[model samples]
Target: MKSLSIQEINTILNGELVGDTSQMIDGLEQLKNAQPNQMTFIGSIKYERLWDSSKASAAIVNENIRIEPGEGRAFIKVKNADLAMAKLLEEFDPGPPQFDIDIHPTAVIHETAKIGKGVKVGANSYVGKNVVLADGVVLYPNVSIFDDTTVGPQTVIWSGTVIRERTEIGAQCIFHTNVSIGADGFGYRPSDDGRGLVKIPQIGNVIIGNLVEIGSNSCVDRGKFSSTIIGDGCKIDNLVQIGHNSVMGRFCIMAGHSGLAGSVTLGDGVMIGGSASIKDHTVIESGAVVGAGSGVMNDVAAGKTVLGYPACDSREMLKQWVALRRLAKN
Candidate 1:
């Protein structure tokens, strides 16, 4: 652990310093967990009362918050304490493991595949025919890239992940373990004789944009005729399912276990909480928020917050819950 003076931390965070500027901080922790050599933060007003009792040598707080006078601890006041904490965490992060070899000899690469400079393929990985791995791409152990797939520069795909045929992943993307991209969508048509379901051939692929990070065990399905598009800077959490032909706008966030059915359109900055499900053909407008466990069957307007099953407006949902509670009490 590297120790930094309170003055150095203030300079890094562009914050105003109070108390001892020479106090040393070696790590960052939550307010309740911070030690004397560690820094903590109060990101909201709700936690302000805990500052005096906090054992941290230094604390990061919002500029607007006034701390009680004569506290022994040092404080760094920033415009946004939450964002400053994020920057500090990034500064202290020890990055992921770096591969020594450019390409492991145990890896299998098809004769027709084009491997770019500085690309690293880990042991037992398979790159199929006509695949294009751009410069600086890293494929960890047991990764499988099917025919004609293109992985852009500096992308890292971890173990057990599969990129199916014709999928296009953009630059600087991170695919965590066991992620499956471009798998066939859940599309089945009834047989002409009505005896059984016929699987619809998924002819299209998945297009993932730059700076996207897909968490472990998530699946993004291939479209029947067009691409399932994940836009720039989108962050998808673990175990999420994105159905075929769904188009997500830039920077949309989907939490763990959330799902979107076929052809759903999510506008820029839409946030879907854990376990939320959006029905097929629905449109969630920009900046809309779907609360945890919500089942969205209709279009959600821009900047709206919806909650509950068959999700309705958040305020309306609260009112309904209150009315139901009153009736039950009676």
Candidate 2:
């Protein structure tokens, strides 16, 4: 582990130090598990008890939170403790050598593939023919990039993820383990025989923008006509399902287990809480927040907050909740 003095940590985090600067912090650990040489962070004041009992050399905390450690442990105060800790961890862990021109010996790169400079292809990964991987892309073990797919620079794909043919992923995107992009959309027609279903050919692709993070086990289906477009800075939580032809605008957040039906259009900064479902062809405007477990059946205007099985106005939902509580008491 790389070692840095308390002063250096403070400088790196831009936090104000409350103790000796010369003290060295070799590594980081959880607040409850940190030892004398490790640093920990107090992300919330609720964890004050843990901070008080922590044997850590130093702690990173918010500027307003004041805690006195019985021992002479140093305190580094910042605007947001959690954010500061994130920056510090990035500095300490500085993941994988930034530039690796070498592909792992076990990786199978097709002869027609075009791999750019500084790309790292891990063990057992497969890059199909005509695939284009730009610079600084990291493919973890078991990742499968199919033919005609193009991954932009600096995209990191975790293990077991599969990008189907012709998918285009933008730069700085992060795909967690088990993500499946460009899978055939759920479009089946009843066959004339009446005993079987006819599968439609998904000739379209998926276009993912920069800074998008798709969580583990999520699936984004390709369209039957045009592409399923996910705009920049979108954050998709685990187990979510994005149907074919869905267009998600910039900075849209979709929580765990949520599902969007095909052709849905989500405007910029739309926030969908856990397990929510948006019906097909629905348009949710910018800054709209869909509450957890809600099923949106209609178009939502910008900046609206909706909640319920069939989502209604947030204020109306609260009123109903209050009434239900009172009725139950009666």
Candidate 3:
């Protein structure tokens, strides 16, 4: 654990300090959980009231909150407490997992594969024929990259991740444990003789842009033809499912359990809340926000906020909620 005096922390945050500046903080914890030697942060007004009850030696507070620290405790007031905390977390980060080795002896790489400089392939990882791994790529144990795939520079793929044939991944991306990329999309049609179903072959690949981060156990399916694309800086949470031929614009965020049906399109900066579902071929324009548990059946215009089971405008959903409450009171 690293310890820093209150003055040192304030210098790092570029914030105003109050109370005992010499006080030492060894760790950071939540308001209710901090020890006397630890610190906490009030990122917003909701957490300000906690100052009276918290026993922490110091706190990082948002300047807008206008609250004083308790008598004996110190406070570091910053422009945005959350962002300041994020910066401080970098100082305390434990760093990467203990892979350490450049390339483990147990890994298998096909002779046709092009491995770049500084690439690290862990034990039991497999790189198939015609694959291209760029410089600084790290493949954790048990990872599998199929034929004709290209992983860009500095990308890190965790254990049990499977990147299927012909996939294209961009630079500095992070794919967490058990991620499934470029698997065949869900497509089936009625048989000509009406016996059962005929499988529609998926011949397309998955293309992911730079700086994307996908959480554990998420799946991005391949397209029917061409590419299913994820643009730069998109962050996909755990258990999220992106379907065939779907195209996501830059910086889009999809929370845990959210799903997109085949051919769905998301414009830049779209935010999909947890468990939200967008139907096939639907268009969600730029800056739209879909609330948690929403079931979007049609197109959402730019900058709109929608929510609920059959998703509608956020204001309209609130009005419906009010009407239901009145009925229940009767």
Candidate 4:
């Protein structure tokens, strides 16, 4: 518990001190659990119930909120107390600073690999031959970048993520933990003997544009023949599956558990709800919304909202639901 006077804390957070400047605060804690040497913030009205029982030495509170100041307890009022507290917390509990030109000895980098200035490769990471990692890229521990892959500058890949052969990821992209990019697509062929199924070869790569964010545990399969592309500024949620050869346009939002089959094309600003599934070869236009648990089997026009299994217009689906309810009432 590092202690700082109220005046020092105010300086750190760039906030005004309205109470005792000499009061000491050891650390930050929640309203209910804050001790005599700790400070807490009233960020939400839902936490107002904790005010009466709080035992903290001081509290950072909004300027508009009124609270009775108890004996020996200080109240620091600020214009935006939540943000002030956030700044204070950041000052005290800062994350690890960005690494500059540091590569662990355990990391394997091919002699021919092109690593730009100030790149940081963590322990047990592998950079393949002819791979290009641009300036300011940070590869977390255990990351794998296969041969001929190129990652643009300032990309941060979390631990245990895999970037398979020839995949191209752009600048400022974030790959969360356990993400698998460019894995083989699910394809099968009929056996020559007509007795069983055989796996088809996946030869194409995945290309992710700048500023795209892929969540943890998500998988983007490699194309069976051509490239699978995800455009810039797309936000994909956790546990989503983007099948091989799919092309997602800029700023698309795909929620958790959503699945897009092979060869699907989504235009700019498409939004998909949780657990929705889009069939292969389907095209969804810009500004479209696919509702939760919906199954999209055909093309969706621009600026429309669809819902239900085998998705239809949201208004139609709601009408059908209301009719069903009326029948049940009768």
Which candidate wins on TM-score? 3
lDDT by residue for model 2 over 1-330, one digit each (tens)? Answer: 789888888888887888663457888999889988899988778888787677788999887776764446788888899899888888888565442446888899999999998899988999999999999899988999999999999999999999999999999999999999999999999999899999988889999999999999999999999999999999999999999999999999999999999999999999999999999999999999999999999999999999998999999999999999999999
Worst 10 residues of 4 by lDDT: 14-23
Best by lDDT: 3
Q: Score each candidate by Cα lDDT.
A: 0.93, 0.92, 0.94, 0.90
Q: Which residue pairs in candidate 1 collide?
A: none
Best first by lDDT, ranked:
3, 1, 2, 4
lDDT, model 4: 0.90
Compared with the true structure, the alpha-carbon lDDT of candidate 1 equals: 0.93
lDDT of 2: 0.92
lDDT of 1 by residue, 246-327 (tens): 9999999999999999999999999999999999999999999999999999999999999999899999999999999999
* Model 2 misplaced stretches (Cα beyond 4 Å): 20-23, 69-71, 97-101, 192-195
Q: Would you give me the overall lDDT of model 3? A: 0.94
Model 2: per-residue Cα lDDT at residue 20: 63
> Candidate 3 — which residues are off by over 4 angstroms?
none
**Per-residue alpha-carbon lDDT of candidate 4 for residues 98-180, written as tens digits (9 for 90 to 100):** 55449989999999999999899988999998999999999988999999999999999999999999999999999999999
Worst 10 residues of 2 by lDDT: 93-102
| 1 or 4, greater by TM-score | 1
Instruction: Please provide TM-scores, in order, for all candidate models, with all chains considered together.
Output: 0.94, 0.89, 0.97, 0.76
The TM-score obtained by model 3 is 0.97
Superposed by TM-score, candidate 2 places the C-alpha of residue 135 at a distance from the truth, in angstroms, of 2.0
